[model samples]
Target: MPVPIPGNPLGYTLVYAIDSPKGPVLVDAGWNHPDAWAALRGGLLSLGIEVGSVSGVVVTHFHPDHAGLAGQVREASGAWIAMHEADAALVKLMRGFAEEEHHDFQADMLRRAGAPAEEVGAAAGQRPWVPAQPDRELRDGDLVDVPGRTLRAIHTPGHTPGHLCLHLADADRLFTGDHVLPGITPHVGIYPYDRDDVDPLGDFLTSLERVADLGGDRLLTALPAHEWIFPDVAARAAEIRHHHEEKLSTLAGLLADRAEPPTIWETAAMMTWNKPWEDLPPMLRGMAAGEAAAHLRALEARGHIRRVQGVDPVRFQALDS
Candidate 1:
């Protein structure tokens, strides 16, 4: 029977305990909150699955919401915790960043994006920096053996460098973490810690195509972190792709407007939906502006745009001229 662990917007973490040749396997350890734990316990009790009955815990990623209480659960259930190896370093970095560096980075990035000093500091202060690490490492295509089920790991990096999704071959079900949301577009901004090869947006597009190739008829159930569960995966992927194309077009148009090009800040302001500088959220404003700059850089690399460095800010213009 499929048990829905309660407390999340998805209503419950869909956990399946099968009578496999081994024992039982737990998919994801949902958010680490008392309420989340209570709901999970209730769901398990309803299914007559005792804590000790759980044999293993497999996580999609190392995000707090997905792998939050994995260690605790592992200790309690005596189940081995498994995650992708690519994210192991990231998990460690997040721990340190949360305690000592995230606020400073956020403040610096916002300031660089032209946010007011005070607002930058305030927004940074409001950011939370709780971090935890994953236990065992999982790799792409690694098969996790459940009682009667087998989940194959698919490396879906975009939202995060180590993000993952699980494919259940027999059931044709996908357990997507934050990689694919139903309604909202996932943020694919460049992270300071990311390498030059980590083009989140590009990787995201590829990941979507991969998902599409996995047979369009499979059911996708995602833990939104907020909002309801959406069964339509392909539609959501298409929507995200369309949103990016629109953003890219808007950015290109902004660059074309200037004969001499403009600074990153100027281009960002133009690319944005003309939101008043003061009313926009500091983080969002920074993200939008930063992403616009990134898009311009990518365009320049492709010979589609030309870049000019000036005293005030760097600028870009379409290359046709």
Candidate 2:
């Protein structure tokens, strides 16, 4: 049985050792906190395994919660660390960007979105960036040969461009990272430096369909950065798809109400009426506005919305009108 880590919103972390012919391989390394590390070690010990027994560490993505202690584990167990190649660059980029550029980027984004100056300053203070890199790079459809199991990498970019989900062939199990969560929906906001060509939301939708095509019987387990293990994979995918569709409808309705095209900030305010601008944290407000902007862009691509560039800024409105 996988042990539950109390107080964690994701319920518990699963620390199971697979009996591979080469040795026991660990799926994900837990957090770097002393308590989290101790709990994982204790859980492994209860299963009659030791830290030295782990052969390799396979990560789904580069998020801190999933890959934070990977380096530490590699040092302790001599396990080779592996992650997606696309994400490897992100891991390196974020580490360097966090130290120098993250705060300013956060502040500027919020400031542009009409956040109060003081709120923007305070929100910039809360940005947390990890500083680490992966030792090995895995790619889409790459076969990770473990003892008695072959985990296939499925690139599921949205929440992050390099996000990956591992599918175990024989076990019929999929290790979904933050790509798909059972409880809370995953965040799919645009990165400040992200290329316009990369449609994360579209990629996410396609990835969900791909996972659904993998068969309904597949036992799904996830390492949600903040949720519990969920079994119903296909249903969850449908829920996410429906959620995005509904958001598009809502955006369309909002756009129809305004005679003049609305800026991203103005559109976002209509979308999040319950959460006032003054009360929202800077990062959240920026993310909310960005998400609205992404929806607008997607709608524009579909010919449902049109963008009009003004002297001062670009604005958007429903296309049919």
lDDT of 2 at 170: 68
TM-score for predicted model 2 compared with the true structure: 0.84
The digit string of per-residue lDDT tens for model 1 on 45-101 reads 777777666777777676566666567677778778777887777777666767764
Candidate 2: residue 103 Cα off by (Å): 6.9
- Expressed as tens digits, the lDDT of each residue in 209-306 for candidate 2 is 87866755555544444456676677788898888888888889889988887766677777853468667655567777777767776777677877
The Cα local distance difference test for each model comes to 0.64, 0.70
Predicted model with the maximum TM-score: 2
| Candidate 2 C-alpha error for residue 120, in Å | 2.7
Give residue 275's error in model 1 in angstroms. 9.0
